[model samples]
Target: MSQISEEEKQYVVFRLGSEVFGIDINKVKEIIVYQEPTHMPGSSEFIEGIINLRGHVIPIFSLRKKFNFPEAGDMGKTRIIVVEAGNSTVGIVVDGVSEVVMISGSVIEKPSSLLTSTVDENYITGVAKMESGLVIILDLEKVIGRDMAEAI
Candidate 1:
């Protein structure tokens, strides 16, 4: 069984278009300013492009696109969240990162079958109830899925 201890799990919250969401801080490698990524032909639609991250050619993918949201240009504090999923590291673009929050295992609740929250349940492991509301905890594996090619 996958053991989920009471250890505090940090999460970074951000907005995807309009909805607010979050991912485990452990998955977020680093936060970087928005940069024009170099295009790589024959890649998936969600794969925005790649960039040379201090000698490491990191491919940046749009999380919005992956969730079927309309594309938006870098206007505000758009950033690339370096993440490791399925043993592969990749960059996920977000509107802006709010703050790193700590959530214990006991506080994490199973996803409610709320019709409004039906977008990507599989990519979500649980929901963290917060004073603001509830922050969706994403599943790292499902977010990256099979994007090993671009990640490598």
Candidate 2:
């Protein structure tokens, strides 16, 4: 089997409140325009509900609520990023997608212990230092949680 090169990694950068965050590009299936989700009874607060994508029912999650960020105001730039986590295809809502960046593995550092207070450290894989700014790399598996993924 061919191995993935560690020399560089591509990430899909997005905004959450004032901070920037990224996810592995390979995990992202597509980015779609924001649409109101149909609320599901007895779902978690972070779970914005589900959307019918083509013939598939995809669960939508609000990253702002998941990260404890204040509710967003304008919806103009909002987007739903469809990602594959485990066996589930989930859509994560973000303020907006910035750009796709390819950064060398050297610039990525382990998450600092201090960040645990602001956000769950388990959800963060690393912090990437880029020319634009720091991007908090998220562990999609942890963010999507095994149980939640299975349920969806």
Each prediction's total of clashing residue pairs, residues at least 3 apart in sequence or on different chains, is 0, 0
TM-score of 2: 0.92
Candidate 1 local lDDT, 1-152, one digit each (tens): 13245667778888777777888887778989888799988888778888888888877888887788777765578888888877667888888888888888777676655723546667777777688877777887777766645444
Question: How good is model 1 by TM-score?
Answer: 0.86
Candidate closest to the true structure, highest lDDT: 2
Write model 2 residue lDDT over 1-152, tens digit each, in one string. Answer: 12223579889999988889999999999999999999998887779999999989999987788878899999999999999988888999999999999977778777877865667888988888788888998999898775465445
Weakest lDDT window of 10 consecutive positions for candidate 2: 1-10
Deviation in Å, model 2, residue 97 alpha carbon? 0.3
lDDT of all predictions: 0.77, 0.86
